[model samples]
Target: MTAPEDLALYVHWPFCVSKCPYCDFNSHVRAEVDQAAWRDALLADLRHEVALLPGRRLRSVFFGGGTPSLMPPATVAAVLDAAVAAWTPAGDLEVTLEANPSSVEAARFADLARVGVNRVSLGMQSLDDDALRFLGRAHDAREGLAALDVAQRVFPRVSFDLIYALPGQAMRAWKAELARALAFGTEHLSLYQLTIEPGTRFATEAAAGRIVIPDGDTAADLFELTRAMTAAAGLPAYETSNHARPGAESRHNLAYWRYRDYAGIGPGAHGRRGRLATTRRRKPENWLTAVSRNGHGIEREDPLDPHTRAVEALLMGLRLTEGIDLDRIARLAGGEAPVDSRAVALLERQGLLARNGAHLRVTDAGALLLDGILGAVVRAQTAVAV
Candidate 1:
């Protein structure tokens, strides 16, 4: 049997050269930063948390950003060393760092690889130059391709992200981009659709009629088209927005979707462990102050109930090509699988769910309506169980 996969660590680097108009991630830009002080604070926080849960085997460590690739190599090296000192790393623990497709960042790839970063997820949000300009990305397509060439030479695994279904996007345009992306021989790709999230500049502009997006039906078609193209190419959707070949699935992300425990350190990072979900303070100074308070943040910490876990597990697992395991669901929820017959029957009749003995899997149609289906089922089951 596979060894128990329990632990992971996340290190958030809160600085960016510039923040994208569409990005709502906890990132900031400043004229100058106290790199040494920030590094010391992060390392100290790691040690403090390690004292709380010592000797757990770490399955992964993901350096999510603003832009982790911008950090000085020595800082990355120090944190990796600190983590190894604190926990036993899995035999093949996956360590990933989010990057941007810029040559300056690419120059540090060799040093980062030497310090144990094996996977690279580059933010090539769009390849078309016009769309690139529309999104205000720093690197052009040529620069991005050059960076990808360098990364492919340095890292064993390289993944790139592309945003699709823009204002005037068509199926043909997306297919061409996906084909070109796949040609790079990347083992994983994150194909996201553009979303005008609240509080984003895009949202504000859109509300003022400055930007227009595809109609609902057209966006739906793009989603379906993405699924079909990737499936044909053997890069299947392993999550709602990511596609990967068989063995190339992101271990760090899977840890979350699988409802496993992980530690989060640094400003604005979120984590869940031992039924408790914690979010670090969003501001850098505030996070440092909170870390001095018994290794927790001042912002928020919520303990998830049993029912909540079950609902979360279903929402996460159903996104995978392999759906939920009934026995595992029962174990996590502290009860038998509460499959609501009405919702199940309705979904199955609509050809949106399949039952493999005890396991219930979401079909492609169901995946399209995942939120609605999950809500109906969870509501029905939650009431029954309550």
Candidate 2:
């Protein structure tokens, strides 16, 4: 069970140099930004949260963004300093910053490390030049590799992401790329399959019949190949898409998957604190204006019912290799676990789920069918035990 006072912090930087076609995150491009103003606003937002969530221990801090690497290092330092002052930090307090693999940003890694960032997640979407171009990445394969080298040297813990299953990509070619990626000696990896999200350039292209991805069977094969290769290389998948050497998994991400309490700040950030959910204003200008007027950028703080919290906890906790305890979830829901016991038994018989006493998990074969399994297994009502 997760401790109520153990917390994680997610700081969002909403500006980026450029947006990719496949991106739909709350990122924006601007001609110029008021760095001083942004720093103050973020600090103010942090203070607002600190006042409410007092006497808590901070387990980790994650700098995520529209490209957090673009922020002035001083801003990053200020935020970290404020966070350290606000909460009791863990002995092994993990501080991670997500960065794009660009030469310019790579140059700042040392400075970033100096200010409490010990881990870096590089966005090297692909090592293939053609795929990089297709993905609309600003950096070429060589530059991305150069950035990776800098990251490995500057940060004690390093991880880089890659996108596979691109249209027209051959299985043999992906295997070669995957093999090369594992040889990089990084302790962690986040490999994702390419998907066309609505409202993105890729979605527009797909609608026009200009873009095509691999079929379901081929995608499944690719996923299995990825899992097998990574496990062979000693970086097994801990969650659906993330892999890491033993003891190297991302602590910040695990906080989310384990359904622990975290405070989110900055534009478009979301937070979960006990039974309440907080959301910040998404638009940059709106967030700034709100901060100036109300001293915080929060747009909403909604209370969650017991059943809702249990359903959310199950949805998140079930994604991990170490599954949730039904008893614990039942406590959260104020009743039984919000699941269909009949569906659980059926899925277990089909070799897609495993349940022992209160512990339940999706099997390796079931991982591919996770979405369907979730839909079928989650009960519509949680007032009674099934």
Tens-place lDDT per residue, model 1, 223-337, is: 9999988888999898888899999999999988877888888898887767877788899878877766655553777988877777778777877768888778777677755
Model 2 agreement with the true structure over 1-386: per-residue lDDT tens digits: 55537899999999999889999999999999999999999999999999989988999999999999998999999999999999999989999999999999999999999998999999999998999999999999999999999999999999999999999988999999999999999999999999999999999999999999999999999999999999999999889899999999999999998888999999999999888999999999999999999999999999998888888989988888777899989998887888998999999999999999999998889888888988988888734553
Question: Which runs in model 2 stand beyond 4 Å of their true positions?
Answer: 1-4, 382-386
By summed lDDT, which 10 consecutive residues of candidate 1 come out lowest? Answer: 377-386
The per-model lDDT (C-alpha) reads 0.85, 0.94
**lDDT winner among the candidates?**
2
Where's the lowest-lDDT run of ten residues in candidate 2? 377-386
TM-score of each: 0.95, 0.98
Model 2 whole-model lDDT (C-alpha atoms): 0.94
